[model samples]
Target: MQDALIVLVHGAGIGAVFALIGMSFNVVFNSSGILNFAQGNMLVLGGLFAFLVLPSSPGIGPWFVFLPASALLMAALLAVQGYLTLLPLRSSVEQHSWLITTLAASVIIGAVLLIFQGTAQQTVRSPFPSFWFLGTRVPAPYALSLLLALVWFGLLRWFHTRALTGLAISAIAQDLDAARAAGIRVHRLQILAFAISGLIVGSAGFVAAPVIAIANDSGVSYVLHGFVAAVIGGLGSDLGALVGGLLVGMISMYAAYTYGGEFQDAVSLALLVAVLMGRPEGLFGRPAARRV
Candidate 1:
């Protein structure tokens, strides 16, 4: 019973992280129908950036100062990359083209991180303290991840409800042609969505790396799991992405707990396969209508 409860808590924590990541990916997928393969790279990039900007590292300023600084700077830089790389693709262009382009971008960004950061697996000293709940030990970074998710979701819910820009972006995602007809600047919205999505994904790196050690290839699994989370949750629903990520996270965490840690990847993939085959539309998503 104790082991079960611990498994649950740890799984839930991991799920929370993946949930946020899925939300970030879902935003871009829903907005532009682009897979944004580079999302994982953005996370790794942010992690590497954190390594560079920390006080103990080769950077200036206090550790506290560098955290936010690195976060904001990385987000901004990725936003610019979002603008430059994705904004130009016409919404009418084939999604495959965008997929290829973005996949290439992911490779490029990942390679760059590897080139600079090397293949070392390293840990980041977090600004938060670790805690235990019901005999389940929790890392500070995971706790921080939960807090970030709450704040980000709260802000997103609020913005979507009240902010014109946020609503416009959501509207564009919902009905691009209708949004255009209503005088929403589709191009600008796309640009904005890319930037915001990049920023969100970048922050995933910022917070998550402290919980798990980061490496040159750290991003591949982070992103692959994120895709599973987003797909299983629902490609079109933000809430679905959150739920999906959490589900995937829990599966991997519990699998590793009960089984061997080495089986984590295979278990995660198997779950993804099972979910995809069982329910393609996902838990909260609506199935597409068949053409007559």
Candidate 2:
């Protein structure tokens, strides 16, 4: 009974973590139609920053420092990435080429992390990045992750709802040509979306580690889940991503527990296949037209 209960708890926690990762991926894809594989590097960046900055200066208590600091840095890096990488390409050829570019970038960043940190594996090296938040028996790292996700999600919601840039982003997603006609700044908005997407996934990697440490190659799963979640929920719909992420999260949790984590990846792919066959448009995504 005890072991089963533990498994259940762990599964739920892991599910939440995965959901966050999925949401991050969806944000960028929905707005720009670009699939970013370099997102995991953001995770690596967060880890390095958290490992270094969180412990410096006035020394804010563990709970007060790591989350915000990591998020801020992640957001900044993502912003830079979007400005430099996507901004130039926004006016260029087919967006599909971005997939290849980002994949290559991810490879480069991963290599840099290994070289600088001398870590051949993808592990969070922060010595004491978290601490007891409310005296709860649960590890501080887990609690921190939950809090960070909620806070970041809320902030993202506000940006998407109340900000001019956010609205413009939506316009681009609905129809880029129309958006351009309306003076929506399509290219710039896409770049912004790219940054936002990277920020979400990148910070997620950082917080996710303390709660559930990952291997170096674990980034592959992160990227893959983000892709799957985007499909399951439907392209360009944040709500859809959230719903799809949660659904997939539950499935992954149970599958990992029942069939071992190794098969969990296969199960997720299976879910994707089933979803495609049952609803080709995704749970909420619209179907693409077939032109003669």
Candidate 3:
């Protein structure tokens, strides 16, 4: 029973982070119809920024400062990447240039991080102490990550349903041509989506840094897992991303606990394959109607 509880807590924590990354993917995908492959690197960059800014034993005040600062910086950087990725093309969906541009941006970011941080994995010391949950020692960041996920989801939900700008963003996602035809400023909204996506992942990276090691090479793994989560939950569905992330996190934890750490990724991939085979649109995704 204790083992089960421990697994649940740990899974939820890491899963929350994955869900955030997935939602970030959905944000940009919705507005621009382009998947920013550099999202994972942006997440790592967020953690790197947090590592540089925060001290070994940071206080609450520092967190308040670091979170917004890291998020804003990432937002700006990703916005620029979005601009460059979209600049050479006439239409985002029509050109398919983003595939190369986004990947190149990711590689460039990884190279820069590698050059500066070296190949070693960097750990961020948690400001809060570990607490015992049942028989398991739970880290503070884990709980924090879960809380952040909840807050983020709520805010996003409200933004999409209530806010005027968010409604515009949603309109763009629904139909780019229609949104533009309605004078919604499609280009500006697309850039905003990129910025918002960066903010989501940046904050996630900062919060999850203590749990996941910060390393330049880890971006691929993060992106892969997050992408899986997004797909499993159904792309463009924020709630689905959360559900998918939690499911992935729990299953991976179970695999690790039962077999070994190495089997976690294998289990996740197998789950993805199973889901795709059964439902290509994802568990929560709606199927698009094709015109005959």
Leading candidate by lDDT: 3
The TM-score of candidate 2 is: 0.81
All candidates in order of lDDT, best leading: 3, 1, 2
- Compute each candidate's TM-score over C-alphas: 0.88, 0.81, 0.97
True lDDT of residue 109, candidate 2: 72
Residue 194 CA displacement from its true place in model 2, Å: 2.4
Model 1 segments more than 4 A misplaced? 56-64, 289-292
Local accuracy of candidate 1 as per-residue lDDT tens digits, 1-292: 8887777677766676677677777666666677777777777776666666663432223545655665576567656655665645666224456766777777887677678777787666665567888786788667666666676667767766699998887787777778889998877666667766756766667777666547767676777888888888888676777777777877887888879899887897898788788988887788867448
Q: lDDT per prediction?
A: 0.71, 0.64, 0.88
Evaluated at residue 96, the lDDT of candidate 1 is: 55
Indicate whether candidate 2 or candidate 3 has the larger TM-score: 3
lDDT of 2 by residue, 1-292 (tens): 5545545455445555555666676677667666667765666566556555544332336635566667666777666666666645744325566766778777877776666766554334333344432332345445555555566667767887898887777667667677788988766666667667656665666666555434345566666776687678776555566667656766776788788989787898999999989997789787767448
In model 1, what lDDT does residue 268 have? 79
Candidate 3 TM-score over all chains jointly: 0.97
lDDT of 3 at 240: 82
True lDDT of residue 243, candidate 1 = 72
Tens digits of per-residue lDDT, candidate 3, 1-292, equal 7888889889988888888888999889888889888888888888888889889888878988889888899999989988888888777867798999989998998899889999888878778888988788889988888888888888889988999999998998888888888999888888989999989998988988888868878888888888999999999989888899888998999899989999999999999999989999899988877558
Clashes of 2: 1
The 10-residue segment with the lowest total lDDT in model 3: 86-95
